[model samples]
Target: MGRIAVIGAGMGSLATAARLAVQGHRVAVFERAETYGGAVGAFRRDGFAFDTGPALLHLPAVYRDLFVKTGKRPLEECVELVQVDPASRHLFPDGTDLALPNASRAGVISALDAAFGAGVGERWGDFLGRARVVWERTRRPLLEDTLREDTAPLGRDPYPALKRGLLRRAPATVAAVGERELRHPGLTALLSECVLSYGLDPRQAPPSAAVLPYMEQTFGSWYVRGGLRALADAVYERCEERGVEFRFGAEVTGVVEEDGRATGVELADGTRQEADVVVRGAPGEPLPGDLGRFVVLLALRGARPADAAHRTVVHGTDAPHDGSPDGPAPTVRVLRPDDDRLVPDAGHEAAVLSVTVPPQGAVDWRAPGYADAFADRVVAVAGAAIPGLAERLLWREVRTPADTERETGAPGGAVPAPALAGADGAWLRTANRGVPRGLYLVGGSAHPGGGLAHAGMSGAMVADLVAGGPGGSR
Candidate 1:
């Protein structure tokens, strides 16, 4: 059996390690954090628990396949899947509230018809159909192909199948795509919300990403019984069964290369571990693209205004039993409120809000009193959306572009790898296989893009390549 050292014990790393161990390779996984699941983490304060990353599960088949291939029962048996009914509620300015049911294409169409008009649903169907095509055509090539082998230089460029399918026909901007598919402003705006959640804008986003909402609906958005972090723990459990070893609190400092090939890693703790292969599964900086907006997060103590959705507000409640101001604003505002009666603590109220600002260079927001400053900014830009939002806060926390960059290890805090808007942005994405041999990338960095499923697929594909297994380059 070959020896392998997998870096980072996030979902991607665990998946890679498990697959490699099942292949009879002696695999060891090193994680920088004290725990597994980089962003897929849970924190318990008092009686309430909060998931730090990934609230819903999309395309659960990806996880199920990983388990079945690794000699385990399907993921459904491992983790209880709860389909969120009404999927989600979208609030609009015109006092229109739309609840999207799980995979309810008809409902969504009907809602569009009621809100926009009769012809809108038909047009929506056409757009959704095209988006489904994008999913069908790109899923295997991008998500399932081993990045190392599939990306190996094939004399000339490969991935033409993926390139032609969604990348070419899609315009370079989210606005562009929306204009083409949607005639009504309201429907288009709703679609843009999806783009934002996926960390992109619909107009400039790669046509490939049009599949996101569809996948969520078709596969059905699921929540773990306890929390989203359970999914990470589930993957970790399977890895352990497969004999994958993990070292937490072991931060990777650098990749070690010799003779023009990756062979090992240097840890922040002053230790070097060698391996037959390595896969980078961490989030990465963004590729310069068409997105003109940047995000700032503000932590608050109360519920955001109901109409905050249209006025640049994203609400995450870490607290409860409180309220914030409401008004019109141009920037995105997020309100995360702490409710002690419902939540665990009385003194601990955590409210997270986000805003859209002009694209700027990275700046640090972790400095002293950064949270208060961020709250001030939120009130300033989205003040009309939340009147008197600032004075109501018990405490404030801010995550600036600089803070995200430093905290997430993403250059310029460019997580979600910038939006894959337009054909040019799509092509600019880095392939899994690097210029140097033996070096491969998984996680949110490589092709097919970010999100848990995409990262897991990247790791699995790279592992397949290392094992010379089926599903590598054909």
Candidate 2:
């Protein structure tokens, strides 16, 4: 068995390390942070806990498979996974409220119909039918296997275009699909927010973006009992069980390349660790269109409402689809999990509000009062979801992209979106192999891209390639 060195203790790297250790390879993980989980961070104060990263898990089977493959214990035994019913509640700009049932097509259709009037549900259902086709066509190359060198075929748009009178103009972007098919402003806004939440601008996202909603609606949303931080803890524990070594606060400076292959990594402290293979799990610098999340964590004095939906999205009026710095008030997502662990007691509640915003490069998140001013706007908007929000607010903690940069080491605090097929593969991430011999890329910045599920898949693919021997570099 060869020695393997994994850089960064992000979800992908942790998954890769455990799998590699099980395969009889000597694996070690080096992380710059004092702890693991990278962007999947947590904050605790006065007995209240909050997940600072992703609020929900979609396609949880990815992690389930990871646990099953790496050890005898399954994911359920490691962490409690609660399926969120009434998947999400949406409040549109026109005061239209719609609650989508979890993983139930018929129920979602009926709900959409009841809120948006008759026939609107059918339109969305039909759109999802097309999205399902996209999912089937790209599932293997995009998620199930390593990214191929020639991704030209995957680059082409796969969403079938509607025939319009003698001329069939295929929709190039996600916005085009919404305008040409869904037609209703509310439906369009819903679709836009779905893409925007992933940090992709709906206006420029590929039609393959349709698969996002399909994946969510089909697999359903899940939450860990404590917070997403608990999921990270489970993965880290699994890595330890597999005999993987971990060195925290070890910053990798550069890959040590010799004879056209990665021998190991050089650390910031002037130490060099040699290994047979090097896996880079750190995210690359933020791209031009990359975006960051601004979160407002509210500690309320009263208990969570009995009728509160686990997730609520309040759509903004101006530039709802655009995630640029100059865009209008951003659409905000409010999360109020029913888990008691998040609150100090039944009398107190924790609510988190998040929105997509320009990365640190586009705007200075640290400029005095910038975070508070933006947070004020977000809280004012969230009042629509929480009854008597101002009166109930006990204290609020604001987190900006600047904080993300400091915590996660992602430049500009920008988050990477999942890979999409279309627009000539503009959205596809870097391949897992072929960059350099003995080196593999895993994480949100690499193949299959971001999201908890995609990160797990990237780890699996990287492990498979490593097991294939040196030729795997091809």
TM values, all candidates = 0.76, 0.96
Candidate 2, after superposition: displacement of residue 250 in Å? 0.7
> Positional deviation of 230 in candidate 1, in angstroms?
1.4
Over 67-141, each residue of candidate 1 has an lDDT whose tens digit, in order, gives: 888874788888877766656555455556455667788887887777667888778777778777766655566
* TM-score of model 2 vs. true structure: 0.96
Candidate 2 achieves a global lDDT of 0.88
Q: What is the C-alpha lDDT of each candidate?
A: 0.59, 0.88
Best candidate, lDDT: 2
Candidate 2 Cα outliers beyond 4 Å, as residue runs: 165-167, 317-327, 469-474
Q: Which candidate has the top score in TM-score? A: 2
Could you give the C-alpha RMSD of every candidate to the true structure, in order shown?
6.9, 2.3
Position 27, candidate 2: lDDT: 96
Worst 10 residues of 2 by lDDT: 317-326
